[model samples]
Target: MNADSNGLSNAEALSRLIKYGPNIFRDHHELPLLIQFLSRFKNPLTILLLVASAISAFTGEMTDFVIIMVMVISSVTLDFVQEHRASKAAESLRRSVSVCAIVIRDNKTLEVPLVNVAPGDIVLLSAGDIIPADGFVLEADDFFVKQALLTGESYPVEKKPGPLASDSIDLQSATNAVFMGTPVVSGSAKILAVKTGASTAIGAIADSITRHPPPTSFEISTHRFGLLILRLTILLVLFVLLVNALMHKPLLESFLFAVALAVGLTPELLPMVVSVTLARGAVSMARKQVIVKRLASIQNLGSMDILCTDKTGTLTEARITLQQHVDPQGNGSERVLELAYLNSFFETGLKSPLDEAILDHKNIVVDVWKKIDEIPFDFERRRVSVLVENGESQWLVVKGAPEEIIGLCTCYSVTS
Candidate 1:
């Protein structure tokens, strides 16, 4: 095979890679532990509580000040630790899903790290492989791709190359195009990489995950509750200070009393409680084989009214087994198995799952046969025929969908 016939020369690929960054999915890293701790104090209530703790220290109330400091530090540390662990756990998962792709680079076939793939490079895809970048199909053989990870549709979709009649089309409907992160269910394809990194369709979806979503119902309710408590605390403190002043109490004493009262009224532990709860939920999910990247998503999961997903790879174990192999006469036939095994082993294009199933029989063997020529399977023809020679004898074996192949058969072999 000519190296130049496959894809870009090495120099060209390197130049394009320099122009466009490596293919990668970008994710937001969590803030530093110290920064996350400081973030806990960003809220008004936490700040108010800190001020009270300081005032207590200044007034020589050592016991109260120590208790307040301990509460603040304990809450901050718990929240920070849980979040840090969750972030690290999610990172491991992201790394696990990262895959490498086979490409033609410098005119030679190479299995490069997926992240190094650049736009315009040629990639070869086959069954059980994951696509690492977006591209148009240059050539295909019975190519079918399962993009349920992106489209939530379990059915494997066939891919083609011609331009659509209308430009307005959904990704699932784009037969001529393939996107990153999808699995090749069956068949094989040669693709011209056109997009990578943040520019690919899946990259856009990954970007969406980073941009924070609108506040959920639980968050809205929590915000309202915080505001309500803040308003009530302000009113109560004012009332107490006004009473002390009316009774001619010392100004300093009244001020300190009001400060203490305000601190007591505020729900300083709300944030801590929420964080711990979410962290625990994340831990539980991890134990049950679910990875929750964002802590806030736990609430959304609980509040979700409708959840929809495919069962093919999720709810059950999907596997193919050679349950039974029979001939036209409705009897088990070693001859049928032998012929099918020869077809699958010799006539290779994009190997189908059925071909795999047929080839799995332990008793099947075809070491004596040699392939001479093949009638390449095509969309319109819908059949594949292979001419094989065993010693001096040569015969053509054909297989396809029953509807398409039935008319071509004028005679039936009903014997074993």
Candidate 2:
């Protein structure tokens, strides 16, 4: 795609849409019809039922044939309808890309649709904002992002403006790269777009969903069982035919008997049973906190020997709280507690559990502090220092990990 003086040219944007837009799973009103048709004969039990019906028809048993055929067709039709409804509901839950973004173009900031945000666009991101595109950070201030959706990490990742090592950097370690779907946990930033739409990291996930292969287990099992039944039915039919041939019996009568045997050998209820089993398993799992996005994932989960999972979100509560406070001065230096409360109260960007606990202090009057200078927290420093001016005096307040803060001060607190 070509870039115009403003950004992407009209032709370029159209070309990108042609290449990438079609891949996006936009909600379609006709999706229900498509899903219904696809669901037929896809389940194992259904396959067996259909095979049984075919055998009954060949046997010349009109009553039995009609009954089996009706049952098979009705079951398949019901399954198709249910699947169609489910697909339509899933489509309704898909996130929309209707919001416009404020981006810098030719040293001028302009608002444009998120879909039109091509690579190399400078996007302005702030606290509580969802990243619109994948990009490299050019500048950031106390920027932290929650990447649980992408990496399954519950903790907010601290981001910095620097050149990331392309060879060694993975998505989690790409300190410079900001991705779509993740929200800015705290602070603001200016980022240069590296990828957008289908080319983005999240876009890769969308592509995986689109190009997913058919259910291997269901297909293989149904085919195997069907072949076995077909072989048995053929043998039974041959035995009857041989006897009829030796006895000089009527050919029509013998053929009808063989067809009846074939029909009985086929398992017409197989599809319905398999469908019910899978649906039951899926519903049971839903009752748990884990949501199985793909139905086939249930089978895959069973086959896994060892699962390597991210510990951030899945294992941790995603909240950091103060477990203990040691006031060694014995004078009950409430000033430290008060200062911590004031600093947390003024911090409008990030809201962690530690900040919540500090805010809960009843004795602290954080609003009394006037205008002042403050230093934002950094992962490397592990501390946040604030200089607040109250009347004529300026108080230097600091809060961080216990070890880091204790190391900076010479005094030690002894418990009674």
Candidate 3:
């Protein structure tokens, strides 16, 4: 394996792996068996039970020994199976393939499976698309994106093609960039893929989630409690054996008594309780729209102090309505608004906040005006011009950034 700057390397020549390491397949059918076997011997409660069973056997109480052993094994086995099944189901749901995207390569657009898209591919995105890769915009058509996944902003951001020069530009302010795992809420654009797989920002988050090594509070508590139980059980068994030996008890009877004491002190309920608690937490989180992919994360959520939440979908409604439009001139403001509404109504195959604002105007009737010709909105000029042949003469109406419109205007209107 060859290491990159972040110490990731290719797992195979045919497929790309994260530079950090090859992705481990989480699914393991044998996991349940392994968990059951480990749980029976490793837990303090289970250890106590095992010691008790050994004592019963030594004491010639065959039935008692058999029953205790059976209960311990059965409980661990049930927990192991239940946990494994839930994990498998969660993984299957999360990894199911849903959509494919069109990518541009060699100056041609081609449909490709989303998972197969690698770095350096150009992806063609339309309105309502979920971005497949992290990229930079190559072509944008009145493009706007909802970057709620990356930034908490609720508004759909207008995107353009150019290097934005701002020291404090947020991810949402990256007008020339698009990121992985966010959906295209409106408009269309062609994006040049800059990163893919684990190299992408979203991929990094996934890697972080996977590689987090800190044990949960519950795990820590369980380990400590189990250790304490194990030590105490060993000491008590030793004390009993010493007393029996000092009392000149028969060899076989003394051995049996020691085994019984060990079995009695083992904690057989701890593993079952832990499994049940995790399962209950998973169900509870699911009810709150938070799917628990990893069982260990259940306890971690309880200990979290700061939760970064996306503001768009999580806090606000997705729809953006025009609150109000400022018209400095009072006289022809209504006319300008009417023209703007009419032009937007007639235009087809385009969607934007400006267009939506025009269409949603309550006072204007868009069908009343007839269109003559229109100069489409250009980002370079930062304006849209429309000529409407209303009544006798044609009226040239334009609306855009106030500063840009002011420079082009020879008249003024003051709103009363």
Candidate 4:
């Protein structure tokens, strides 16, 4: 089938729609409410308490049964309410990352739901665009994509229209194919959507990121303690029932007495205490501008000896500001900014935070400057250079890490 700027015809798009379903990836294992509630019963302490309550009710000790039931209801209800709120918060966060994209269909470029993007559709991408689907580069101009989500490499990867001879190439080396959720670092491209939703490489990685329980030491110790208590409660209850029966006590009285012993031994109030404390902790965290997605995580967090993670969107706000531009001898210089902005503004490569900051500073009219050639930034080179021709003069501007930028200099200029 031919694919172009017009993309697939309406009939063809519809046909593929039926075949591929939608461009959406659903996390496959969301437990139902009833199952979630039932899962709480898996705890040994909860099971033992429940059994004691049943024995109390069976022996017609309605008051004891009612008291135990109240505790169980209070504990479970608090837990359920807290977890439900947390789940909703997580879903809202996910929605922000999954946004719409523009695709060409029937000769018209239109913004559509990301789910509606299908293979063979033409995706028009520009700088700062977050790619919603994987595709082959049909056309490109100095395009660079940041695939850190997939490749874990901080440097942006350049892409161009080319033929791959084999399927054995690694994803980072697949220079011709674009992946979903990666941002266009700079430049622009007309990409033909080859994979969408779960079929893309990033989608597969996301699919593998199932919500498995965190391996917290506190949880492990708590579980082991519960089992130890379960064993002790069983032995104590059995011994009491045997002794009472041997003494010719009434069966109902003996059962009731044994149930009371089990209740006392099982730490029946612990669950209620934990639930209330965790809920309070969650509220406290929210007040401090920290969102605790799982209330149970509070205990795990408290028990953490050390925790390490990315600082992006966590320790630091993602926004960056241009602080100051200066020359040698610590003198403020507009020329430093002028040169930096010109280098940033003229280059046809991926823009960095430093570049954005420089561009956002007081703008200079560059209508007379003609961009000559650009030397793109790479980790090895540690810089980007832009040469521009203005009137009868031409100047080369370079920007990069401070150490690297200084290393290339033979002389320093100090504003007097």
Candidate 5:
């Protein structure tokens, strides 16, 4: 789709929606409650305890069997309940955020739910907005995107509309294309959606992680502990059986003694203890406004001594501050700052970090300046202009990259 042409009509968008499906990763779909509850039984410690309870039942020790089974069921149920609550809380938190996309439909721009975005739709992206689908840029204006999710690059990359080189094969080289899940760090763009749902790059990555996630440290440790316990129990039981056989003890008494020893060696309350601990951790984190869908992840996070994560929003505050505004002589200039504030404040496009910094640096009284017209920032010109009239006179204020703006200046202001 070209910039001048109206995007896909309403009927065509509907047809494409049916063909492409909703724009979602699908990995977060909730499993059936029964299936989720049953999954708790798959824990190694729980399974081992269940086995011990089975041996108790087989040995005609009904009291011991009942006790062990009760403890195991209680632990599993507790864990399942805690995780289910956490999942519900997370879902509620997610629903609280309105995830919608602006798309061009039937010659008008409309904000629709993210899932409604389909192939052939023209999506509008602005600063602080995550790209909703994989698409080619139809128009761009100093558009910079944080593609750390896809490229692992800490710096934001500039994107513009153009034909890519023949050697452009990786995500980093696709300057004309945008992918889902990456946030627009600055500027604005209009893109033609070409891929949605699981077909998008981030969706495929999410699917891979969901299907073959590596076992967490908690899982691995529990499995090893369970196996260790099983090995020790087996060795002790065999040693006791050997001694009893050598001594020629009564068969029924010896068998009962071995069974009793095995049952005693098993840690029936281990599952309950772990589940309780994890549940408490989950509740503590939830109180801090951190929603945890998996109780085990709390342990994982606690165990981390040095976390190596992206710098976008994890290690640093996601904000930009204006340190100084100066003229060519490197001296502070209130005039320059006010002009920048006027230019940024009057522009109607998505506000970038620089614009926000300018507006927030100092409060300037703009009641006298009436906005007339604006030339929105674009990649080609690398600048934004605002036409302002102050009753008797009119002034055109411009802000942009240093080199671009300097190239257009006939004279430079050394001081106020």
Candidate 6:
């Protein structure tokens, strides 16, 4: 498990890849269409109605059997068609975005799909790049990572290449290790990947939740209703049989009478009614750009009066706005925005949220300015500087965290 500057050779990487398999969390699987459709009948109430329909058919009551079967089939079909279409659309949207990672192999750096990333690969990561797998930092320069997904701490944690202490028993204390699914907040690092795919920490969480989810509220209620109907039907059938026995009625006629009474008591159209109603909700929600994978979930959503979230930005569109541009004295300054717009417009590196907001705030005429050089932002510096020149003079425009910018400045300008 040792790595040098050249990283693992192609032969060795391929061998390890075959041994460990690809680095991916293959947690979800789609069932066959027939199986998915048949699964709808698993509902207790639906199963009961199905059994009642079969019994009616066997008892020479074709009319009763036809009515029950048609309602059940129509209900199941409506639910299946609506949900299946929505899920397919969701899948298409998901496939549009692909993630890639930078890997060093055969003494060359290459960008490859995240799934193709294998153990022993040297992964190069920087700001905004997600960690491809669990690995120890081999080389880092002021590297900081956001482990909020695993540790629930919103602040970024600094990581450097070093040996873990003997007391480092938990993930929170694993300072030298970077895990899968964590995003690099700032700076850059080179890691020797030790674990990939299901062996990684996040992959384990995905695997644990891969099984069938617990039944929803709608399912529980329907099951209870089925049990209630079963009890009442049994009681009524027994009472009818007893009355016929006391009157000395024929055995076949008495049994048929009991069966007819049970069929009459069963609500054949209830499933259809519920399915159609939920399907309508799904259609309306689709119009509003919400994908509904389960019709029953529509009911659950309707019942929720207050939606709670773990944090403010978690449910947002991730779009930030430039509310105001000001100088050091809290007075509005178009000069402040002019420099920001120039830097954001000419910078060649990855753009941050503030940069985007500045560009979106307003259009500034920048034809007179020509770019000269640039310094990219990193965790250590916490700021980015762009050197631009007009027809006569050059200006180094900087934008970053207020504290970082103030620390670097020896003098300040105030507008009053």
Winner by lDDT: 6
TM-scores across all candidates?
A: 0.72, 0.75, 0.68, 0.74, 0.75, 0.75
lDDT tens digits, residue span 58-97, model 5: 8888898999999999888988888788767766876787
Task: Please give the ranking of all candidate structures by lDDT, highest first, separated by commas.
Answer: 6, 5, 4, 1, 2, 3
Number of the candidate with higher TM-score, 3 or 5:
5
User: Can you list the residue pairs that collide in candidate 5?
Assistant: none
Could you give candidate 6's per-residue lDDT for residues 1-416 as a string of tens digits? 76677878778877888999888876588899999999988877788789889989999889989999999999999989998998789879967768899999889998989988888899999999999999999998768888878866655677888888899897867889999999998789999999999999998997786656787898789879988887888899999999999999998899899998988888889999999999889989989999998788888889999998775545665677999998878889999999999999998745666788999999999999999999977655878899999989999999888898888889888764
C-alpha lDDT of all candidate models, in order: 0.78, 0.69, 0.68, 0.81, 0.84, 0.87
Query: What does candidate 3's lDDT look like per residue over 292-348, in tens digits?
Result: 655666878788899886454676665557655556633335556666676666654
Could you tell me which 10 consecutive residues in candidate 6 have the lowest summed lDDT? Answer: 310-319
Residue-wise C-alpha lDDT for candidate 2, range 51-88, written one tens digit per residue: 65665666555677687777677656655555555555
Q: Candidate 4 residues 203-308, lDDT tens each? A: 7877776556665665567678878888998898899989988999998788777777886666768889888998999998889877776677888777788778
Clashes of 3: 20
- lDDT score, candidate 5: 0.84
Model 1, 1-416: lDDT tens per residue?
12244588777777777888878866566567777678756555556567767877887877878877777777667766776776677777778876889998766799989988888888999999998899888888879998877776656788977776486368888989999989998888999888999899989989888775676676567666766776777788889999999999999899889877876776666667777888889889889988776577789889889878655455444445687778877888777777777777777656666776777756554677789999876766888888899898998888888888788988877772
Deviation (Å) of 44 in candidate 5: 5.1
Error of 5 at 410 (Å): 4.6
Clash pairs, model 4 backbone: none
